[model samples]
Target: MNKERNQNFKKKKIDAESSYYYALSHEIRRKIIKIIGDNEFTSFTHLKKELNVSTGTIYHHLETLSDLIEQKQNKKYYLKELGTYAYNSLKDNIETIKAPQNEFKSSFLNKMMMITSKRFIMFHKKDRIYTVLISLGIIILGTIFSILNGFTSFFLFFIEFNS
Candidate 1:
């Protein structure tokens, strides 16, 4: 019975730790942590202002982080020892999550490729036939004109030679 209770307690702690890490993975959460670290204390309003996030979003993230840090007074939050340790452990990984340059490039490329693919698909069978017909008509007209002009020049030379 004691062993089972200890196991449950450890499992809860691990779950909390995982949740804390997942929350901290977000860029906004990292900014919040930095802001909290700088101020040492912060309210929801100030956090929303500084982070430029919706009040609900800020509060949700704060609540998640607070749960990891442990709730103390009502409407107030602080990072406890576990929270501090989690933040420190995640510091390096958090820095990489900021701005996401690679993700932006990939998204841009995907959009470009989608647009190009649509344009290629827009070339219907009629359009293809029209292009081929136009090209063939131009070639035939040029060939006929060239042959007629060549015959006229040859006939003129023959008349001059005979005269």
Candidate 2:
């Protein structure tokens, strides 16, 4: 009887682990875990607003995440122990998860623009001076190019007028 009980317990544990990973498999479910974990508690309406998905979609993902999350009497959802674990894991490995795949080649200008935009959007305090200097350099170069182009056009007009 004790051996049978132990087998049952092991089976349930395996099921729980599978369910937890299954919940993490979907993007929406991961987002839900992050939202709830970050907020400690959140409402269905808040999730819907943040996700901007159809009601049915939210319902489906929430159902899948049932093992990870729980609702309180006040109708707010919060991460369960498993949910918290998932959230921490997700947070820790988010960079790896979001790393861009080299599926397509981008032009040098495109890569530069993306790098500059990302730096502008996510720079740290230590990078502030570097970012500002790079931005100023770009602006100065643009202004110089514009002025030179204007002079070139004026010189061409002057020559054409004389001709």
Report lDDT per candidate.
0.67, 0.84
- Candidate 1 lDDT over 2-50, as tens digits, reads 9999999999889877877786788888777766665666677777788
Model 1: per-residue Cα lDDT at residue 150: 55
- Quote the positional error of residue 33 for candidate 1 in Å: 1.9
TM-score to true structure, per model: 0.48, 0.58
> Candidate 2, after superposition: displacement of residue 8 in Å?
1.3
The Cα error of candidate 2 at residue 66, in Å, is 0.9
**Deviating ranges (above 4 Å) for candidate 1:** 70-75, 90-163
Candidate 2 structure lDDT:
0.84
Candidate closest to the true structure, highest TM-score: 2
What RMSD, rounded to one decimal, does every model reach?
A: 16.1, 17.5
Q: Give me the displacement of residue 115 in model 1, in angstroms.
A: 49
Q: How far is candidate 1 from the true structure (C-alpha RMSD, Å)?
A: 16.1
